[model samples]
Target: MAHQLPETTSAPTLFTHSHPQGIDPSNPHELSASLYNEDLAPTTRKGRTWNSYSIFTLWANDVHSLGNYAFAIGLFALGMSGWQILAALGIGAILLFALLNLSGFMGEKTGVPFPVMSRIAFGINGAQIPALLRGAVAIAWFGIQTFLASQVLSVMVIALAPGAASLQQTSFLGLDTLGWICFVTLWALQLVIVSYGMEMIRKYEAFAGPVILVTFLALAIWMLFESGFNVSMTTGESRSGLDMWVGIFGAAALWVSIYGTFVLNFCDFTRGASSKKAIVRGNFFGIPLNMLFFGAIVVVLTGTQFSINGAVISSPSDVVEAIPNTLLLVLASGALLILTIAVNLMANFVAPTYALTNLFPKKLNFRTAALISGVIGLVILPWNLYNSPEIINYFLGGLGALLGPLFGIIMADYWIVRRARINVMDLYRTNPEGTYYFTRGVNFRAVAALVISSVVALLLAFVPALHVVGPFAWFLGSGAGAIVYLLMAKRRIDLADIDGEAIAVTPKH
Candidate 1:
């Protein structure tokens, strides 16, 4: 499965080519411009039809997850009117779409995973920074989703045998004994999926996403009907005008922050796409379209739950548990729990495994990397991270602050400064003359922009006066980093530095 280096000629740009006969399996580290082999090429194209549906499946898993619903309802609880909540949700979705579209274009252009494509802007070795950060986030999320999924298992277990609730009293690693068992069980299940690698993950998503979607849609309709047509739920109650607006903004910002890890690694999946056009089409359908539908579900479920319980419950698990006899409740909760775990495995667990393995390909392949990441995630004790609502919000917010700027710097370098072009062949070379190897495999400009912009964003998050601005942290950080990187890089490098004629075009999937 080793990738061959791209064939080079005197021509300044590298074009995609299939490897002749057998590929060298020994040197897995020796990657070329097109990080995919013929075996890895996508199978469908624009007119073929199925590719669009497959692409749509990505968001079904993303939106159907427990975390997605939890965050959306939490935003609704913020001090804003119904219109304001809808505005925040819409704005957040659009912004995420733009970010995904930009990142995905690189994948579509290069036909390479995120880590591979990042080599151009981050340098062959320098790409490790973003890779590691993204990997860490993924691992953390893997542990978290496992814990959340286990809670559903706990519910089912307790329902089956009421005595099992006693296990909750026995403490281990800050979680109850039953919680530990469930976490370990879900963790083991994820390993099984991760062992199969990317293709299986895709297939799992293709299946899980659609089933989960259909079930959730049915669940939402049932809840609305059961609760009656006049379920009254207000968005929020703000103390003052400014406070209300600020809180609403923060709520929206939180949604963007939740997808920080996904935003970074989306290219990993998109790289398999046949074209940039397909990538944009996928993002358009996936982000905004999915979010709109997902929000509808959240609002309906939120209102129905309030009417039934007299309090807003953000977690879908809590909402599901309230329904006494409904089969739909049991099915929807179980499906969501499974779907979230699947997402955790696909989105969070898989990225770090591949990214870390790419860092040390000589000694490690996919399995070793996954084992290391799983162990690291366990060491983090993700259940502890989820113990407090305030702590979880701050933790996610902190990560988002860093991610916003990192994305901005990378995108600015690739799109604005490089003008959507890269020396694909040169990306593999360690030689200083290669386009990516600037000053000992580091570009201080990108690094500086990331640090400065992240600091600004963090300040916005923690400062009391600036806390009101926290909801806009991602926008501020991303905008600042992109602007700074584009401005600074423009002064040092011109469009002429990139060969526009070198656009790589491979045969359609």
Candidate 2:
């Protein structure tokens, strides 16, 4: 088969010779240095080292997060019994498992990350739109997560130097002076870990995941014992029948919403999977099972907090701080800090690294982009963004509405519109002749789909009536985007014309 890349004016990346999946050498399509880099290119077989356990650890790190644990605790405060909350979580976990499998399939089979996988749908140059959007979201969240992790550090510092508690009285940019020191401290720590790249991240995650699981599980057990093994299930008035089902689905949707941003770029990790079965096994154990068990732990801790303290404390830090024993407090604080770093690196760090690198492949490799992102994360003053409702709701929330449509359009183009067929070489090359290089390397059809779907999705955010289904905004928006894209694609890739043979174009593993 002929490599379809254009003749480059300058030298292609070193990836041309080093990686088998790079530009072909003989009768080679030398990928342009402007759009091609080793970091963004498909991984070679030797590079795919993540096993089933690696994948499991990935989610374990993500699920055990302080934010996620807090969200789980809030579910019980809504009058739902323990069983009801568990059912809702189960439904949401399965939905995440299913969506991740769908989003990850293309990357796993192709050994390509999310940004490159997007080239098939968004066109090469036009792919920059989603890349920029994803990069912005990732950077913003990265800063916010770092700010959160810093708070955990604050707890540890005071546990050691009790005098550090005085630092809270003085404030700057919504954080105290010592908070700044701790923020940068944790920031530097995460920067060191992220700088080592994905292989190192995978290894650290394997260790962090199991440790976080043990620590949090132990915290829950201790809390259970402190509360005399008495846990309350109901905090508010109970409802059954259709109302109960509504609550269950609503809670399920909310639980799944926590993953809304992460899922769009999930291919970044799944692309390194050692086997298809590994991803399946990992997703099964990591998502529904892990979510269920972790959520159960959160429920136990929160219920016991209510029993012991006679108050509902949802924040993990608050719950931990309330622990009377200094020894347990120190250990739990350290565990929370580890999980925060694990989740931040896996979720917040990796996406922006790839997205930013994709925009300027010649000037920016993974490390350079990562450094740039980390620096920007510090300068953004993310504490303000987290504290301000107007900015959070309008600015970030508005931009976030696109995540679903971006994901929807990609899924639609890959599965529904194109029916899984793709021209792989075309994804890397910038030539007008390449299959994906539509209309100056931009797909107006996909753009139109995004604008239309985003508008539909945003209605749920603004409209009072639609707010009832706001928990499902991502799901609803994805459906809207997919339907629109499929409709638009009928002219370009006729369903009846390319139904049978098109599947062979993008080679299978």
Candidate 3:
């Protein structure tokens, strides 16, 4: 049975459209009655919506994390100079911006979250596989980010009370007593925020983003004053021009790999966007311009590290630990901790919660799903995983490899195979006659393409013989998946039958 929507104000014009031929508004049996549930239904325009600024804040929260800071500084070790590194980051940012816009447009048009939007390409039941895969990766990241943030908090605690260092002597589950305290504290905080739902999450990021930017700027200024102006930007490595260029490209690929998962799941945030223009504008500012500024700050601050501390400092926490003033150390640590929490909530927590909810909408709502994700995050024991580079590489690299093919398949389905025309009602239907219910409610062609591409990419990433292409695995997989899916689905897809002007809506079931 379908529940009736409340008698509220009408939705905006962008969301209002005539029902498709097969969808009978008076007869719920012919509509997507099963999917009319709150978790899977299209968002009503009258509900809370995000503008360009909100969208910008989402990326701001994602990019301004301790891990991203470390990643930026680590690029210096790749044998590239200041300008070369900036250029690589800039190129990567542009590519990211373009990809985000494509994914965001899909969300805005459909007014549906990533997992729901995925049904268009993967079929109603088949979409759960990708959704669960993405959720598991996000859960792992949630644990990793939580562990990283707790380390910063532990530093702050030890700085405030020097005697607290004694807690480090007692260890359990690969973490000290103080470490467990901080980790559980941070974990509890994130769970509370997510429990309030997406609106609260949006407000939290909006406030945290500006404060984080300012704090980072302050850190950069402090470093500049201490190091003075005579800092070397060169790596002092004698490599040919071709080798340098290759290194620069490799750096760009690394940056792409870092955010590849977000690129695939961007529709999660963009689903709440007020309009397409707002999402596009937000992505442009949030990605390219924001990254350029961030990269410049990292380059300048890191270049002077040799003068300040006699060596380049890759981790931000290391720089904070070196500070002599306890007050300054506490302030910096708090800021870093807040930034980490913000990133973990947006990038790691929300996506998986929604994905899990999509998987079991009847049994689990947002809050329940979030709690489940949090428990799994702790169960992963991410501190152990973080300490081992081999494990981290295999885990994150494997996840990154899958994202590229997922992105490729979704994009090809939306733009090329379907020509941006979706049978929105059919997406939620279980009937065999429905357009999307291909072969037991699964598109095997897409499944095969994703599997084949991911396997090839993983081989390149893990196998020692093909290590040369490991860095660019994301690009290779995306290309391979796109080409393969297009070729396989060319005959089966009917662009003529699709209605381009149709918009998705939640019919009363």
Question: In candidate 3, what are the lDDT values of residues 1-509, reduced to their tens digit?
Answer: 12232232333222123346643445433434444445556665555368899988877767767778788777676566778878888888987888888888887776777887788888888888778878878888899989988888888888888899999999999999999999999999999999877777888889888888887788778778887765657556734588877877877887887787887888777767889899989888888988887887777678778665557777767777877899988988888887888888888898889888887766676788899999999988999988889877887767767888888888998888888876665666577767777889888989998998888778877899987777788888888888888988745653433321223333221
lDDT of each: 0.68, 0.79, 0.77
Candidate 1 residue spans exceeding 4 A from truth: 1-50, 233-253, 326-329, 388-397, 490-509
TM-score of 1: 0.84
| Per-candidate RMSD, Å | 5.3, 5.6, 4.1
Report the C-alpha lDDT of model 1 over 1-509, residue by residue, as the tens digit: 32332243333323233224433344222344233332222222331222455566887788668877777777666545445666667778887888778777676555555665666666777777777777766777778778778888888778767899999998976999998888888788778777766666767778888788787787677778778854545634534577756665666677787777777777777755656676667677877888888877777777776776667776767767766775655676678766976688767887888677667654565666778888887888888877777656677657656787887888878877787766554555555555776778777767777777888878877788986566677778878888877766634542333231132323232
* C-alpha RMSD between model 3 and the true structure: 4.1
- The true-versus-predicted C-alpha distance at residue 134 of model 2, in Å, is 1.6
- Give candidate 2 regions above 4 Å deviation: 1-27, 172-174, 490-509
**By lDDT, highest first, what's the ranking?**
2, 3, 1
| Tens digit of per-residue lDDT, candidate 2, span 1-509 | 12222334443332223334654553255456666666766665555878889999999999888788777777777677777888998999999999988877776776777777778788888898888888788788899999988888888899889999998899987789999999999899888887777888898899899998898788788888889998877665666899899989998988877788777888888878877888889999999899899878877877888877668777777768977988888888988888999999988888888888888787787778889899999998999889989888888888888888888899988887777776555567666666777889998889999999999989977788888889898888888988898888645642221111111122212
Measured with C-alpha atoms, the lDDT of residue 438 in candidate 3 is 82
Candidate 2: what lDDT?
Answer: 0.79
Query: Model 2 clash tally?
Result: 0
Global CA lDDT of candidate 1, please?
0.68
In model 1, what are the clashing residue pairs, if there are any? 250-471
Better of 1 and 2 by TM-score: 2
